[model samples]
Target: MIISFIGKGGVGKTTITLNLGAALATYLSQRVLVIDGNTRAPNLSFLLELKEAVSLFDLITDPKNIVKANTEIDGLKVISSPIGSNAELDFEVLKSLLSFFNLSFNFILIDTPPSFTSETLTFMELSDYSILILNPEPLSVIEAYRALQIASRMNVKLLGIIVNKFRQDAVVSLEYIRRNFSLPILAVIPEDPMVQTYTLEQKPFSISNPSTPAGRALMELASYLTGRKIEVQLEKRGIIGTFFSLLKKLFT
Candidate 1:
């Protein structure tokens, strides 16, 4: 299945895309491919520390370069876009490529630019499912609502929303969002400082620090997607843990 991760910029779409892909591949042993659809400001390559790698643009120029562009990272196949390339993004070509990729990959996850541009729209329209990522801020939720409206208008199949960078102290609670939006809440990833450290170390927290709150949330999401159960040991955080437990009860 092809799933596109969409939201406003700086809301953690790339982070979720990479970590979720890692979780699916490492734990479920699924054949997953993550494509960097944010051609304008691509960061997946930088995070993976892929120097001078073959990119999606290269494959678009010549379809035969598919084997070369499919680079492996932490058991997941990645087709990252050039960091500063000025190549024109053709949505039609991308559509065809995704169709061809369906034959080989169990999951094709796309990380798109954080806007309602043609690139983002095309990716959403092409996807079999789309997940909206947003932070626990009022403005972010408002933006996500706008995105949901657009996705509905486009007749896109929305899987749900993944609330990234979640904080127990945030003014906007998960229950508030649940009451406001019609879409189901898929996951709520906590704000963990180790995420920055892992990114600096060129690793996904899902694989490098699976015990972290963010990592566990991502693994649960992967499990929800694949219907595969994996044991995850949770660490207690006293009041914070109690708060999230309440939220989980509300969600159920």
Candidate 2:
């Protein structure tokens, strides 16, 4: 399936896409390919610690370069966008590339730009399914509502919303979102510090720390997408851990 992750900037779309792809590849043993569809301000490659290599733009310029453009990182295939490259994005060409990817990968997940640009629309239009990523904030929720409207008009099959960076004292509650939006709430990923730690370590938190709250949530989301049952054991947070968790909630 070709799935696209859509959301506003800094809403953790890339993080979710990378971790979910890793979870699918590591836990489910599924062949997954993640494409950096954000031609502008692309950072998925940097996050994966991918060195200089052929990128999606290379493949778009020459369709036969798919062999060299495809990179393997953390058990998932990736086609990253060249950082700081100013290449014109062609929607038709991108669509054709996705068709080629669909033949090989069990799942092709595209991380799109934040705004409603042609690039974002092209990814959404090409996707067989789309997942909205948003923070639990009023502004983010409003933007998500707008995204849903766009998806509906484009006839994009939206799987659901994944509430990222969730917290107990979030401005927008999960119940409010469920009551307002017409789609299901796929998962609620907590604000885990381990996410940042893993990022600095150049690793996916879902694969490096699958027992973290955010990690478990990502695994659950991946399981939901695959329609497969996964047994993710809850982490045992003792007294010190509970105190720190409560402290984080109190501060953030």
Candidate 3:
């Protein structure tokens, strides 16, 4: 399946995509191909800990060079473009390139830009499913809904929504998110410091520390995507926290 990950700039879309790709490759033995569709800010290369070498732009531009350029990191293959490279995207060309990769890879995960740009639209058209990431804040939810509207208009199958950077204390915001969006809440990722630490180190937290709350939730989300019905669990806090968590699920 071609699953595109979308969200606002700071919503951790790339992080979630990398972790989910790692989980699928490590646990399910899937040949996952992660494509960095965000040409302006291609961070997938950095997250894969790879040098900005031959990019997807380089490979797709030359038809005679039919060979796919990718690097295997952890257990998945990644196709990324160098950051700040002004390689414009042609939808037809991109569609052909994705079609080529789709035949060989089990899953194609495209990490897209936040806006409704040409690049993002191309991926949406090519994707079989989309996973929207959002925070518990009102503006984030509003932006997510706008993305959802675009995805629906483009006829992309939305798998679900992932609420990232979830704070246990934000009861009102959480309640608003639950009440507003119509798609299934795939997973609620906690605000964990390890996520930032791993990002700075350019590592996948699910692979490095699966025991952490955010790590475990991401793994469960991976399972859910792979046809398994895994339940998402929150961190165990005190009685007041438990009450709020129960309230968070009322709109589910």
Alpha-carbon local distance difference test for all models: 0.84, 0.83, 0.77
In model 2, the runs with Cα more than 4 Å from the true position are: 69-75, 231-252
Please provide, for model 2 over 168-190, each residue's C-alpha lDDT reduced to its tens digit, 9 standing for 90 to 100: 99999999999999999999999
The estimated TM-scores of all candidates read 0.88, 0.88, 0.83
Q: Candidate 3: lDDT over CA atoms?
A: 0.77
lDDT of 1 by residue, 1-252 (tens): 999999999999998998899889888888888888888788887666553476787777786676664434545778887666677777788889889888888999999888998889999999999999989898898899999999999999999999999889998999998998888999999998878766865678787668888989999999999999977554444345545655786799
- Poorly placed runs, candidate 3 (over 4 Å): 62-74, 228-252
Error of 3 at 69 (Å): 5.3
Better of 1 and 2 by lDDT: 1
Q: Judged by lDDT against the true structure, how good is candidate 1? A: 0.84
Weakest lDDT window of 10 consecutive positions for candidate 3: 63-72
lDDT of 3 by residue, 1-252 (tens): 899988888888888888888878876677887778888878777776753355677767664332343344545876777778777888788888788778877888989987878888888888888889998876778889999898878888898889999987864366677688888889999988777666765777777667677888988888877886544343444335434655776767
Question: What lDDT is reached at residue 182 by model 3?
Answer: 80
How many pairs of residues collide in model 2?
A: 0
Q: Candidate 1 — which residues are off by over 4 angstroms? A: 70-74, 231-252
